[model samples]
Target chain A: NAGVTQTPKFRILKIGQSMTLQCAQDMNHNYMYWYRQDPGMGLKLIYYSVGAGITDKGEVPNGYNVSRSTTEDFPLRLELAAPSQTSVYFCASSYSGQFSYNEQFFGPGTRLTVL
Target chain B: AQTVTQSQPEMSVQEAETVTLSCTYDTSENNYYLFWYKQPPSRQMILVIRQEAYKQQNATENRFSVNFQKAAKSFSLKISDSQLGDTAMYFCAFMTRHTPLVFGKGTRLSVIA
Candidate 1:
C-alpha cells in the first residue's frame, strides 16, 4: 500500500506566484501533517489535520494553508509564495489511536525553489 | 516549549562496527514520546525507532536500539553491525498527544566499506 504520496516532486516559482502541494494517503489515517525542511535544518510543522474537514495551524503556517476535504487528500496552498517559502515540503500520516504520535509515515517530499 | 537537540552534525562509522548518535531534549511534561527517523538520499522519512517517556526500558528494533535516559532527557540510537544502507540523515523528534512534534537539526551518518 502506498502510505503517503506528495505530488509535484519539484517546482520553481516566482516571488508572487501561487502554487499548491498535493498530498494523499491510502492508509486511512486520521492524522496528517505538513512539514518543511530547510537546508541543514530539521522538519518544521507547517500545518496539520486531525481528520477530514478539520485543519489547524502549526508552528510555521505563515504562508501556507491546508484543506483535508477527504480522508485521502490534503492539499497545501501558497497564496503568494515568497523566497522564504522555498524549501522541501513533506506530508506525513499516522494512526494515533493504535500508535504514538511519533510513528508517522512520510512522503518523498516536494522540493520548491522560489526565484 | 519542547525542544530537541542533536549535537553531532555528521558522523562516520566503519562497516560491521557499531555507532551511536546522540539526542537530548527539554520538556516540562511528564508524558511524551521520542523518536529516531531516518532519511536517505530519496528524502523519504522513515521511522527507525520510538520510545515512550513513561517506559523505563529502552526500545530496540533488531540491530537498532535506543538508550533512553529520561532523567537526563537524553536518547541515543545505537546501530550494531552497521551496513552501507545505514548511511543517512537521522533526525530526533519529540511529541505528545495533541501536540506538534519538535525535531532536531539532524545528524548525517556515513558507513564506510
Candidate 2:
C-alpha cells in the first residue's frame, strides 16, 4: 500500500548545501514526524505536524525545517547542511495523537551524508 | 523531558532460545505509552509491541512479550524461541498523547544458530 514513502534513499551533500527530504503517506494519517538516527543515539525527533499547515519543533530541530502542505505529504528541509547533520533520516505517520492508536508507520530511511 | 534508556548496546542468543532486552524510562506523566520498535539492517522502523501506562497486565504478541513495571519504570522485551530472522536493532520509546516519542539508544540483538 506504500504506507509511507521517502524520496532520495541516499544522498551526499557538501557543506552549506541545501536539500529536501520528501515524505508521503497514502494512509491519510493526521500525525507526521521527522526523525534522525545517529550512530549510537536512537531516533531523535526533528519536527512534527499534526495536520496540514500546523508544524511544531521536536527535540532536535536545528538546521532543519518542515512543511505539511497536505495530509499525504510532509517534507523536511536542510537549509545549510553541516557535517554534524549526517545521519539516517526517517519519516513516519500515525492515525492520530491518541496513545492507543499511536503506532507509527515509518518510511524507508533516507541516508544523507554531509561532507 | 522524558528519556528512554536501553543499557545493552548489543546481545546475542542461540536460535530457539529465549532472550530479554532491558529498557528503563524516566517520565513524570502517569499516563503515557511505551513501545518496542525493531529496525532491521534495512533501517525500516517496525512496531514490535506497545503498552499503556494504565494497564498493569503485560502485552504479548506472538513470541514477543513485555514485562512492564510501573513503579520501577522498567519495560523489557522477551522473545521466545528466537529465530535467525529475529536479529535486529531494538529501540524502546516513550510517548504521551500530548507529545512525541523519546527513544532509547537501542539494543542490537543477534540470534545465531
Query: Across residues A1-115, which tens digit of lDDT does each residue of candidate 1 receive?
Result: 9889999999999999999999999998898999999999999999998899999998999988899999899999999989999899999898775236537888999999999
Q: After superposition, how far is residue B24 of candidate 2 from its true place, in Å?
A: 0.5
Residue B10 displacement in candidate 1 (angstroms) = 0.8
Best by TM-score: 2
Candidate 2, residues B1-113, lDDT tens digits: the string is: 88898999999999999999999999889999999999999898999999999999999999999999999999999999999999999999999867788899999999999
- lDDT (0-100) at residue A99 of candidate 2? 42
Q: Which ten residues in a row have the lowest lDDT in candidate 2 chain B?
A: B93-102
Candidate 2, A2-115: lDDT as tens digits: 899999999999999999999999998999999999987799999998899999999999999999889999999999999999999999998865444468999999999999
Q: What DockQ, between 0 and 1, does each candidate earn?
A: 0.63, 0.72
Candidates' TM-scores?
A: 0.97, 0.98
* Winning candidate number (DockQ): 2
